[model samples]
Target: MTVNGRRVPVLSAEGVTVRIGGRVLLDAVDLDVHAGEVLALVGPNGAGKSTLLGVIAGDTQPDRGRTVLDGTDLRRWRLGDLARRRALLTQANSVAFPFTVREVVAMGRAPWASLPEGDDDEAIIEESLAATDTTHLHSRTFPTLSGGEKARASLSRALAQRAGVLLLDEPTAAVDLRHQEIVLELARTVADGGGAVVVVLHDLELAAAWSDRLVMISDGRIRAAGPPHQVLTAELVEEVYRQPVLVHRHPVTGDLLVTPDRRGSRPTRTPVAPAAGAALDSAFVKEFS
Candidate 1:
């Protein structure tokens, strides 16, 4: 269960905070990502979803608190060493060079350049491409691929990294519906194979459908963190997202299913903040009044 050369507690954040121009982007946030689990970060736009991913990936330093990989601080790990242990697939990846898909995926091995694991690297790269269902485009130019295709290619590259911990920021943003499901399924398979996977997802349905745990964030803090059924309640969803939602058990899987009541016509109730000392505004009071 060790990840990135560290023990089983692959990723941990304690009182983590990030600020940009005096505005708190993430405040006092604590999270843990363990091996063989898919932890989904779900929130509305500007909820610091990507910022949190950057912090975990060692791309952005937090203003306060600590992020640890295994038992060591994230800063202690060299960039190249960190890259070898964790792979981050961001939302804004673009290929300026017209490298073929295979070449692009092979770049993931740069961290292990001096290692004499040639055959293992090649097998992993090929498996990554096939897992992402981009094997057919192996010889295609990266710059010439469609948006969705490019997304899959980037994902394949991350997979090729063969890192024990994987962080994805909006991994399905540019892909079509089918590709979205495919990529999420691949993430699930990776977690099933004993890697730690953290994905920032905007689609609630997809998050509920695939994630083993859910971390809901709002206004620079974690609103709820637990299994999907406990955290993604109807009232909490409406409070954090400002949209009425219905929570039900999926008929087939019996997992929690969150459906937005867009019209807001349902008989809804106000949400009670989970923690003491958390503020409760008049609007919430009026809703339940």
Candidate 2:
């Protein structure tokens, strides 16, 4: 299959299987991640999206099969060499030290230390900060930043790596609405620049809007894989997500929009509590306390 007019696969996962304590996390998963395309993985919690990403990033060993990068097994590549070819942005941005934002981003250049481009670390770091809209946070300590700020800083660090492929797990989960849009747009820009991007996302609307292709996984298997419209049908989503959903094209952008079907459900409202000193009936106190 063609990806952004490119016909070659930059990353390939063949029969990848992961098992933990005899429970399958991913079973016989085969996928081709192509250059110049943004592929989004969507599924319910515990569906193994992050595990698959970990396997592809060479951070986790699979029980069977292998992940290949540029026709070579990822297991055979050196750690430093693999870092140069791909960057992984995990869901958490936990930091124990007091490193400044710039210092954290500068660490991404470690893999290029032996190359001439290593000298451009400062320039790349600045560019990555600006691209992620975190330039103003350069002097702040990473451990002191808020969740959203930390997410932006982490993305800047990953972007500074300047790798050929990006594996982002929930890159936008902690950000606000605008930053969420910014992060996804940046991923698209990376793909447009001939890099492959694989993103794990929970928002079906955003995944449908941003991804060129979608992979829906459930129960440790791929439920569907194809264009967003093909993979995000209302029937399939309702079945896999275990809830009713409405999938329709937007009137303005013509992009697919997903909304939960709540026609038969009662509108949710908070009940007013009794005053602290007010008398309570024995039945009410027994039910609550």
Tens digits of per-residue lDDT, candidate 1, 1-289, equal 5558855677998889999999999999998999999999999999988999899888999999989997799999988889888999999879889899999999887788878754588888999898889999999999899888988999999988889899998999889998999999989998999999999999888898899999999988999998888888899999999988888987988867788776757668776666632445555777898
Give lDDT for model 2. 0.93
TM-score of each: 0.86, 0.90
- In candidate 2, what residue range of length 10 has the lowest lDDT sum? 275-284
Computed on alpha carbons, the lDDT of every model, listed in order, comes to 0.89, 0.93
Best by lDDT: 2
RMSDs, each prediction? 11.9, 4.4
lDDT of 1 at 15: 89
Score residue 98 of candidate 2 by CA lDDT. Answer: 98
Runs in model 1 with CA error above 4 Å? 1-8, 263-289
In model 1, residue pairs whose N, Cα or C atoms come closer than 3 Å (at least 3 residues apart or on different chains), thus clashing, are none
Question: At residue 244, what lDDT does model 2 achieve?
Answer: 97
Best by TM-score: 2
